[model samples]
Target: MDTRIRRGRRALVNWLERLHRLAPAKSVVWVPAGTFALILVLWIGTISRIQAEGREARQAAAGATSQVASSFAAHIDKTVHDADVAVRWIKYEYERSPSTFRLDTYKEKGLISAGTALQVTIVGPDGEVLQTTTPEAQPVNVSDRRHFLAHKSSPDIGLYISRPVLGRVSHHWTLQFTRRLNNPDGSFAGVVVVSEDPDFLTTGFNNLEALGVGGMLVVMSDNGYLLSRLASGEHASPVGPPASAYREMVDAKGEGFTDPVDRVPRIVTYRHSTQYPVAVLAGISEKVALAGYRHARDLYILMAGLLTVVLLAAAAIITATMTRLVAARARMQHLAETDALTGLPNRYLLTEILRRRIGRERPLDRLALLFVDLDNFKRINDALGHQTGDELLQNVARRLVRVAGNKSFVARVGGDEFVLVVEGMDVAVAARDMARSIIDTFELAFGLRGNSYVMRVSIGVAVYTAESETEYDLLRQADLAMYAAKEEGRSANASRYHTFAPDLAVRGMRDIERQQELQYAIQNNEFFLEYQPIVSLDTGDTLGVEALVRWRHPEKGIVLPGEFIPFAESTGFIIPIGELILEAACAQFSEWMESDPRPLYLSVNVSAAQLVHGDLIGVIRQCLERHSIDPRRLKLEITETAILKDAALIARRLKELRLLGVRVVLDDFGTGYSSLAHLTNLMVDGVKIDRSFTRGVPGDRTALAMFQSIVSLTHDLGLSLVVEGVETEQQVNWLRRFGHIEVQGFYFCRPVAPGSLQAGRAA
Candidate 1:
């Protein structure tokens, strides 16, 4: 019947019905919904008991205190009124016979004794020799007294009550009630005083059980001057200081007031007598008033709660089997989207989360995806049992969660592979550092079973782009970078990470086609050579030509070496590819000598792979011998790094070629290894300055100084010099100032097909 319980139960039912939608359509109603409903009903029943008990406790306390106050005021008002009537009678006697009064006679007649006041007295106008109700009274004056001075001056001061004082006649602490006496012509006579002992109010208080053990009855002046306080069966001494609790309420001329008792927050019920100067305050114990009600209410609540729990238990037992079935289905659904080994989100959840992020993303809002794969994790699985490998994966997943925490979302998408998604502006800019932290998580060796295994991971990162890129595109880019890191062996030492670039995706697609068609291109003679003339800057005479290759893809027109050269080197296709260039260059040299001989030589590029794997010297000798060309006319241009790898082997090969009359020229000199490791260690005929340096010499002072230093170094070595990438007149002017040197670049002529270029001068 309680409205609160009904409302709370209705809300709980609505929420449970909505939760059923998340469960499968034809399955038994979501079993947790029943459990939730049971809990809500019990909770509402308990709250109803608390509210009802609290309201009854407050109302009972208030009603008890109000009844006590009314009884106290009625008793107090009669006492004060009797004192007032006796004082008025004493004044009439004084006026009937001035200067003489029989207060003793009145006491003997028992008129004052039957009154509320203890004694009555009369004072002279000179304020001396007061007639008090005592057979043998000692002389005493009350001129310095408050009640006496109040009545002596004001004719209508009415009845006045003084602060509690000990009387000279009665010899007890008393509150003085005084009234002014006036002559027949309205002149001041003296005052008639009556004493109220205050114990009279507590005459029947000990038998009133409703006051309880700690209840207080206080009678104080209207001005907050305390007269007396009867607490329990004892009275507070009249000599103590005055007290006030409801000073604000009492000072206002209201009929009566209540307040917190003694500032302890317990309520004081007060009522003022209508015909008297004093007010009555009765404070009943709140606990005493509500004691019986609370005991009965608590027992009822306890009994009801047990009943509710019994009903809830019966409902749970009826639905127990259904609940277990629903829980099993929910667990199965969770396992479907989770990795069993690592307990991390699987590929399905990863795809869902990434697509959801993209769907809600705003312009310029970026997301970084990092794909991490343990390098050579297969080796660990083969060495250790699957149980040990599974343990290791679990530990790694925990470490990833610890390192990234809530800053990024991490998921395990495959065996020994994890993905982390971090959202921010251009987060890929911080990709290297974030990636390094992930690698550092594996710094300590992982303990599995009884053995320790050290694992390292390679991370590839991709950042989102604003235009046309989907979630799948970012994932694919990150995967490509991961394989590149493993293939390039970049993660073996520093960085241990690779970031995706737009060109990497382009190269990735091109490599697929190139890897499939590369051998075909070499076998069908689809490769051909292009030559760029090497000329002298001052004389403008062509001294040599460099051989470059191109693939004329049937469908895509001519494909540059940049498109497939790195792919060839990685696949060892450059070895066969290099042979074609060497033979073509030697054959061209023979054609030059026969047509018009002027000691022209042909230079061919040697890749780092060819120098490492191929019989470079044998290939050159065979070409020279086959074309019937002199070895002097053949030159091999090698990069500085090509010799840095296996320097001993390349150096020995270079010597054999040199002895056979072939010249070795260092190509792209200023770009790599500025420390002269290759120049000093290996014998070379000349140095060719890289285009990056040649292009900057006319504008950048640092490039100019570097060019000057290389020129001085080669001249000091007594080696020949050739500068490439000389594209403008400014560059030509600068080189001419440094004296005569061989130069070749676009300023002279671009590379052309074999028969298109003359043997001597460019263009």
Candidate 2:
């Protein structure tokens, strides 16, 4: 037997030596074996880490939920205690003077406050509602109500809290705190109750972040009756009784369990109120609690799996695999830096380049950042389809790059905005030349979808002055300059490019300060209305008044419309400002109609922003209805520039207003490019010729002729005409020559405070 065993061992050793000699076989077996071993080790470690992390996450969640539950319990206990005190007070008052007791009188005397209870009621022993705090006390019987029966049957019951139920008197969901009221003989006389809205208990705690998604805050009685539940900041109805697992978790003070109803894992904690037979439960969704852990676990597992696959495959074609990985990384970097739509460097890459250039030991002597913004891009985009808009943006980018030349870098920063960096060889001059060239190129229409579309851009230039200027400051200055360019280009012949100046920075800061002040003004009612009467040339009597907004700045004394009107329009504060003016004007007009018994109308100037973005029609309707004023008494005066901006939208809105019986008119009529079109398309009831046209009126022959022609044309079109800025009697005389034309100017009355204006006359 020993000789046979020795022969077997010699045979095995020879076989192993032969196997080791085969290099390809060894490579095949060892590579997969090593991969398998690495994979097993990684998976084991990954699983262990994940399990430990999950446990830690659960423990943290349980601790947090327990804290929240404790807080909620304390809050509820205090709330119930206050309600019970109110109940006891009412019980004492009733037991002392049942006949003379009145909830209204107590409320009037400030003995009882509405904050503690939604309603207070007194129920006789027969369960008949005797008195209530509700304004309109209705007869109610609660013979079978749990709150009343619980208090009446047990005199020892100090304070019984009832589940949420519809109140017999208030007809709203409320929780009741009741106590038995006895006579002098110690017999059950009646029950005094303080009913509270369940929402009041949870409304004070608004930190919903503590309760993650699908989590809930619940207040339940000892018998497991849900009194109030809040989920996701909303009141929710009971889903049913708690499952056995949930009960067990509550009993343990805090634990993790799988909810049977939703089948979602949760970490739950509860606290029993020491003063009341109730508990507050705070449950956090385990999924949300361990979201970060799960994410890390998934990433690690995926990485490990990929590593294993790569290792196994890399043995063959190791060089090729490395080459492909390098190429893929390079491609990814490119993708990250490049804008997907315009194929230009994105904002990220632009920021990086700017920072690098600005942060160098020797900064570029002359670097310029040109911020280009497409004018009225949103309007055009909305007019044309998004597809066409995208195409247009792409074409614009190509043109910009072409105009910028190879020396400059052009990046599409965001939505219809591009940033061009010019350096070397007089960058400021180069920036100006590039901006002009780009503008000229855009002047020629671009063919999109077989249609020609002309687009314009506003360019702002900011040249680097010092190394102290940061990237953020540079960008902000450039952006401010761009807005300045846009504002300048509002006219037809103004320049579309502006250079950053010290004043521009000052203006930007002032604008921010003013915006905050304006917000405060709106909140504190610092704005008031001034009325200027519009007089009829024929009757020589005040016909209507134009509502003008005036800001009573606490510090500046008084800020005129011109000082902040344009800023308000730009910042979209004009919407709220306009609403206030409209409502005030309508209310004033309504009062005038009641006192004077004369037909009068009110005119409120509507900004272009208000016309374009505000709910003009709805505001008008609400004001008219609220003040009980006739819609015809309210006339909206929209500027011709506003109509020219979005003629179709403005016309539709005006038509809707007219249909509601409100009159519409055009202000600053002849200043816009499309005055005739506005008159015809807008269906306006009247036109107020701009103050500029009236400035040279009655004296300048040219102005008089133009005014005559406008009056004739307006009369021909059967539209009312109001000649504005009639400062002199001669102008009014000339206007009157046109046959009873309406006139408004300082000659009639300057704008005055609402109190200064009389019922039937100007101030």
Candidate 3:
């Protein structure tokens, strides 16, 4: 047994020595050198074969995806076309006989004639009902909807189908299709509408076998409201498009998309109609579509392995006779550093390059490192299909390489993000140029399949100084700069050491703190009403004081409205803050009126969000009743933007408030777009010149002329004019010449506390 063990050890040692002799060596002149060369050739050939097979597999996968997408789109296109034809026919019938095609005709014909057709209704131009097939149906006003009005005004008066709505008459799921009736001379007339059952549209999609598994097919609106579906399992409940998918698809007009469902391996195909503006979505489980492909791929892989073995066997025979070997260490290294999806360098290569560059003779060279992040990349991936997304990313990589020239290093970090390292003596200039070029690259129209896709990139650049010695520090700075770029809407933003100055860095933090403090001030009763007495220019009696926001900071003492007012407006904290001030001012006026019995009004500023609030009138009514104050004594001040944005909504809100006896004044009149137009349209009690013209009016003739013209126009329109930011006697005198006397400014009082306000009364 001992002799056998010793013999076995000797045999193992001899085998290891032979393997070592086969190992690569650069010193060999011909024999072993030729062997190594041959070995390398064989290895390269094997790699080439593997790469070819991989490319073929990718091509097959991409082709299958394209085929499925095309098939689904063709099916949807045909379905929509057929539906359009049916709708056009019905519209033609209606236009041919307007009176006979009315709702009364449908009622007389009854359910037998209509068959599965739901209740029919006819409506006039004003959205008022002309007639209905069923008397029990609830009244529906169609004028508020844009789609209904569009068809009614169209020259062809084509049939218009709304997204699915629950039927009021039949109480069944239906889509309402309407056709417009025109007078003999092409004048406007009433509309004839018919309800169609959802089953009619969903029948074709109800039964589809995808990869031999149960899959769902859904139809939805452009905004992602579910219309119909063909699944009955856990997905029985109606569902809209997924949030991620919906966001991606809504902006993709007249385009078809295929993307994977969240976590679940499924393909979602969505297309929006150019005619109806609705989206149709269909999905099949991806696990099922690729089942056969996966099996074939696996078989191919096995065959490839066998082929590799056969080649190796053939090589071994030739090599044994010729004493040749091969080495593929360098080729393997190159493959490891490259990206398979895009032929660009991977993150690993980026790091390696960065390390080497930093360790060179000129270690302290100024370099700019940029983090390029594709904005809304997920949208591309979701809307254009992953194959398209992959193609786009490759194109983007090539563009970056071209734009960077030979002076920079560009690599795909992960997903749609790429890192670019620019080595230059002037880091800042290089960084700015690269960022501008990258941003401009996506500005041009990108055409794909007759559809154009516009994309944008957010770039963050960090310039490495001599202080940045380590890779981690340099990368960290780049990342921080990238975040800054994202905050700036991702076009181009850089971060520098000096950018962290005390004032710049703390502004946002301070604003956030102020917002929180103001909210707390409201809740803890730390805020109090401070009224600036507004005296009448003619009578010398105090008209009212504009209620100003004042925060009584615990440590910082009293802070004026100017300090925290902007912070409040930005954070939407102003809504509640403004309400608190309104309630407090009204209550104070109620108390003051009871003692003096003088006619006094309190003016409070209202934000855009507050003006748009549906309950503004209700809140005003509540505050008046709570304070036992008359509504006429309270005035609401609104900025120009507030009234101009959705003028109809603001007009309605203001009209309601006016009806409740609360006066509405358009404040900061000239600062927003079309201020004069808004002032004329809205029933405003007064117009206040914005502080910009007021503060500069005293010396500048142009400012004075603009201010005078505004005053003249306000008076000509029978609206009172008030000057804001009246500071020195010169400003007040100059304003008086323009017949503008009612003013608020530092000359009257610097928004003082209520206790000290009486001492600084203007009158």
Candidate 4:
């Protein structure tokens, strides 16, 4: 999963790089385009919503107007029915007894109300007014009225309603409701007319609050003649031509249209009376009906516009920042792939180049990789300052580049190692010749700080085979050949360069296998410890023990330290193996202290790799704390080589250990250079004599003298001394001459398991 994620990220970076290379400005243009698209979508959605709300508002308005129209129609029908009943009573009384019938009599009895009509009159068959309810009882001719003419012409006309006209007797505009007066012979006699004011019908049914501003309530005849109309809280006289569509319309329905009277867009509904020849129209203006919808729609558009502006600004800022970041990342990637000091391709880039070259579609006839390593570069670096070493390495890089020319690629892969890829070579001999040329060129001394120092480099040449080797395999092979060259250079008749042979491949494979085995051994807990007693020569009593790690290989039975310790050290497996040893030794010593009252200290060897790379001090502190052992009871044994790597750092670590009350001793004392200086400067608690010096003690006088001198030096310095490689009683007896010297060898006890060691063993 991690590999897949890394590949995906790399692919994305590559794509971006290509885009930037093609058109940098065009890459950010999409931000504005995307913003515009988003705004368009917002506007489309908002407008659609506004339109939908407007439709709903219109529907609601239409429904309200329709309801108002229905109510108005019902009221008008009732009023007309009541008026017809009064007219029939008047007609019946007149027809029954012309002598007794009188308009004043009906008015006195309260049967004829002024609310229903303006005046009531009886017209004789000659079309002249005979009796009237109005104060003007003057004689008048009413034969020309449509109501009177219709009733006089036909006896079948029950009740006739006339359009608004000027009353002959009252001299006012009124709608006449008339019934025929018939004699006992079934012939028309005269007309009974009820004069009603047209404005009364509209005023009686007006609902200004429900209709709103610019609303209308109108009653019209079936012939399209307007009877009564009220608009915007005011009575209106019918002036325009009758609406022909209203006359043709039979069903009660609602619609939106422009009103002819006011020229206003309105939602209008029409309801026709079932019994009467009249219809009611209720209308509401569109502007008033959709006022709220318009407000909300405007608000939505404003908010959307503001949001679009903010989003576009943010997108612009983000695009600018991303553009700058992309440019910075390209520069950083170049710097990362190149070495800082040498200004050459680093290991990471070297691997990629090698992979690409090896994975090409067309294979080269002969390809070679040269692994170059400086001889004793670390010694030169340590003897002189690192700055000088760096300058020297740079000079070497220039020289190697010169030797390789332009055809080959050279890269610095490590502090003192460089790799060169030679392609297009015709034969294997050419590759070897190139390696020889590199070695021969480096034979000259490098000039630094006005000093001419001869620097030798070992070169290893590995030729590529088709379909058989990978980039890693080539590197490994070249490295192995380089080590072989260094080994050969140790002899008198030595060659400074070597080509990779099949034997070197075998050796490399063995090394790889050994490293794997060591790793497996550490992981599986296959390594165990055996403690060797450090006996006090004065009292012949066990004072302390040194812990030695041995690997119990599953296949090789019991593997001794001599076989795998150096391998483990070189491969960095020693750190974990050393940790295991320290933990086991501390635990075992704690157990011993618990069972027995002996105040014996435990000494665990510290490897060079552990001192330099691993967190030695923290590991020791944890071990001491975990086992609940006194710091003084735990001694760490370090070789002079470990201190030589970084003396100041090691000294400081040793001082911290002393502060913890832990003792630090130099193991194999006499073998390293400046031993006495280390003893004084490093503040060591004790020093152990190398086994070589003790092997010849009492037999070889030179060895005895050296051993005695070391002992006297420790005693004089107020430092403890332990002699290693004590074999027979003769050596132990000889070591007794050196008073207060401790011996650890087979003479006292061989290294054994925790169960085998006796508590009070004395030599």
Counting only residues 3 or more apart in sequence or on different chains, how many pairs clash (N, Cα, C under 3 Å) in candidate 2? 0
Which pairs, if any, clash in model 4? none
Cα-based lDDT at residue 121, candidate 4: 91
lDDT of 3 by residue, 588-609 (tens): 7777777766777788988877
TM-score of each: 0.39, 0.55, 0.39, 0.55
Error of 3 at 172 (Å): 99
**Cα lDDT tens digits for candidate 2, 651-723:** 7778888899988889998888767776766778989998998998777888777788888889999887888
lDDT of 4 by residue, 170-224 (tens): 8888888889988889777889998889887877775557888888877888656
lDDT (tens digit, per residue) of candidate 1 on 1-763: 2233233234423433433423345544444466567667666766676667766665666566667777877877767777778888888888888756677777777776735467778887767756887558888887888787887778898988788888877787787778888888888888888887856665645435767766667777786677767665467777654756445444232122333333322335767878777887776544455567667667767766676677567656746766676688669866886777766667876776666557555324367788988885765765576877787787877777666545565678888888877766667665666788887777778887777777777788888876577778888989988877776654254326788888889889977877779888999878888989999877888988888899988788898988888789888999999998788777876777788758777888888778768888788778888898878877788888566556676777888878999889998896665536667878888889889898787889999888888888888888889998999888898899878799998898888987888655663
Q: Comparing 1 and 4 by lDDT, which wins?
A: 4
Task: List the candidate 2 regions with Cα displacement exceeding 4 Å.
Answer: 1-338, 356-362, 376-379, 405-408, 424-426, 487-496, 695-697, 761-763
Models, CA RMSD each? 26.8, 44.0, 50.0, 11.7
CA lDDT, every model vs. true structure? 0.74, 0.79, 0.64, 0.80
Residue pairs in collision within model 2: none
lDDT of 1: 0.74
User: Pairing residues by index, what is the TM-score of model 1?
Assistant: 0.39
